[model samples]
Target: MKLLFIGSRLYDDIDWYVKRKNIESILTESNENAINLDLPDQVFIVPRGMDGPKQVAVMQNVDAIVPLIGIDPPLIDVAHMKEEIEQEHGIPVIAANVRAVELTSNKIKTKKFYDEIGVVTPEYQILDSPDDLTLEFPVVLKQGEGQGGKDIKIAKSMDDVEEYFKNFNQALCEQFIEGSEISIEVLGFNGEFVALPPIYKGETTLEGTHPLSKVKTGPCMVQGLDNNLVQHTAYKVAKNLDSDGIFEMDFMYSPEKDQLYAIEVNTRPNGTRYLTTATCGVNSLCELVNMAIGEFSPANISDKLEYHYSTEIPVGDYNGPCPNEPVKSFDDNDFVVHGPEGYQRLTARADSKKDLDNLISKLL
Candidate 1:
């Protein structure tokens, strides 16, 4: 069947579509970015933010549309574009509806949905006014549509809270839940769903800029976690929101209080799409396409995939170098990157963390 992969600028998205055999794949890009070789059936680079019918008409001949756009500040509208595209064109949407995407993209809205369904989230308050800072100090405030802790701030005192809010427009304030934070990636088709093994998020620092910002994801963090609990919780969120196809849900675990707080819901493929697939052995793109084609059944939904874990490290210490193009390194030795099925290792080389950090950080 013919499929149009939206948000195709991302490497993972491109890789996903290209890997599927015997399918017509059209990759759309926002800007004139370079595409990795070995592409799928067909690739097209559409102008950025071309969501209106005039733009999407390019794919009127395609059977279904699969969006691969990442989360953005205008995320609610971005996600809702799925429905807009479907309605504008007489094609079937392979994921959540516009209303559902709106609910999940807006943090406050998502929390309310979770509350209505009896799902446990954090003790958070949406600050519509300056006086809404009635909560005590040490509260964490994150940007509603922000990612990787870009505009996050911690208020140690009421004064600090007030001062910070004056600078930022939209934010969600929550009582500090001190403990390890864990994130899980799940893939779903129709009403049937499968929760992949959870991954541990490590060293989330807001030191230089934002503390609540995400730095890196490690192996499964808390052991003996009720996998069933995580699965049930995630499924409930997906089902409650009537989410379809692939999605990612994050959660925070307060070990001291023994509480599980539901975090934000990623309505689109996350930055770590490859990492999740590496850990879970689930071809989200393939499965998503299959589900879109009505190939999923309840009996085959729970087939668990295996994922190994590993980390990124520098190569060596050859300090002094002066050249036009900067140098880099990757560690094949460090045990940080591992999986049972596939051979995972550092794909490049560098000297120090700072030097290695210069590599293209984004997944695109």
Candidate 2:
């Protein structure tokens, strides 16, 4: 068997590294050949970035084609274009259909889907303009195409909402649940089967090693939150949406209300998905391949895995920490003590806030 991974250059794509690692793992387990092709980067599905004929040529000879397109919302349409091309060429493209991707990509649409399925999610509304509207204060305003928390803002007043609306073409307003945020990574095979593990992120230094700004950057550290209620909810959502491959679903659990509300769904191996490999030892990528190849046997899957929660203080901003020092303590708000290990810069999306807080408090 032969597999072709359509993605960008390895150095530029950390997620691609995870993909490469899984390819190696699958190869180790089976007698198959695999090759990774770095598709050129370009705006949209322009002809210059990828040669459709060339892809068709490769697909004709490969047993499977897995496109590693970025998880940006706009790119949903672009991936659909590639799917069309691949299917027309008689190659089995293992991808969530454009409809499925679109539903998850657009935050507004995702909210509607969740509501229709009787799944609880934060109450939200869409704004096509910065015009006047009646919404509760302290609402969460987010751009439709936002990932991580980059375009996410907590609007405290109507004036704040209007100002944020002026900053973007479209925005979403949702009731803010004051609670801990959790990212659930799910893997579905053939759009009919699914598995999920809860990845918990507390807080981290604003600066230092966090990679929230980059695509597919894993959090500093993560522990599996063995909450079956959360895990089951994630699995149900992925399946109801016909999600296949690797995807991430974010939720904010309100301890005050003891409620969990779905935030949004990412259709690709996003920064949060990196937890399965980088932090936890789930190895979701390897499972993706096994499922893709009809290896969904009972013994091939695991119902439980080791999980951990950090007892370290999460450094949100390490601006003052010594360049090569381990995080010892945050002192005078200028710098933290550095140890022989230097600074342990857990990249943004790296570790949880509590994890950093615990670590820092201990050192201090």
Candidate 3:
């Protein structure tokens, strides 16, 4: 089978699996200098947007298009392309549909979706001005769209809300739940969905620090919160969205209130993949390949499940030791190192928690 993968940013994560399956790999990138271009069997430097990929897929007669875009800005365009390509061209696009993207791309819409689906999310209001604020202080102020903590602030007072409004006219302000931050990656394909183990991304702070900057651990050892509950809720969200590919959902567990609140969902490959794979042997990136090749099913995923203790630490400018070939894979190595210079992170796993602790100390 031949697959046309859009964006080379995440191709490396699944290159080994593609080679093992002997699937012809083709990739298209907006920039010629993008990383992981060497991993694909063929590469096409195309103009930005979904038009270039659509034309390339038709010209090449590729069997399917698996969009590997890791960011949010291009998802809406990709969703439109998915609709047109699958309907007009009769070629499958392994990604979220337009309806799913529209509901998830906007934070306000996602909040309403949770309410409609009976999933618990924090109480929030769309505030146009500081005077319109009804929620108490220490609220999380945010725009309708953003990722990785962009355009987000924890407002503590009217002055904070006013300061936030100076930059943006409207904000989706939520009653801040000061508690443990958790993320789960759910894989959905052909009307089937599976939620992997949860990752414990430290507590929410008054400063609104994102999980990206904090150290994260696997299997979510948060007291008073069950991982099964997280998995079930994530599965519900994915079933409601009813889309393909990956659904990375973020949630906050309040120990004080004993409540679990859904925060956000990204209908694409996300930062949580590495830790999720480290904790559980199922790689969502590889599963995207499975989805494209008609090898995806609940039984197939259940067979690949393996539990291990894992942790990811933000080790800027890693001067530590390196692993063998297939650096992204945890097959031989106990860890994987990733990210750009001065902000790289090291993720490692072991059979037991005690062994994981020792491995991390020695790696550091």
Model 2 root mean square deviation, Cα atoms: 9.5
Worst 10 residues of 3 by lDDT: 204-213
lDDT of 1 by residue, 92-168 (tens): 66666667777776778888888899988878888865577766667888766666666677777777777877887
Better of 1 and 2 by lDDT: 1
Which structure among the candidates has the greatest lDDT? Answer: 3
TM-score of 3: 0.98
lDDT of 3 by residue, 2-27 (tens): 99999998888889889989999999
The 10 consecutive residues of candidate 1 with the worst lDDT sum are 325-334
* Model 3 RMSD, rounded to 1 decimal: 0.9
- Candidates in order, TM-scores: namely 0.75, 0.67, 0.98
Which candidate ranks first by TM-score, i.e. highest? 3
Write down the lDDT that model 2 would get.
0.54
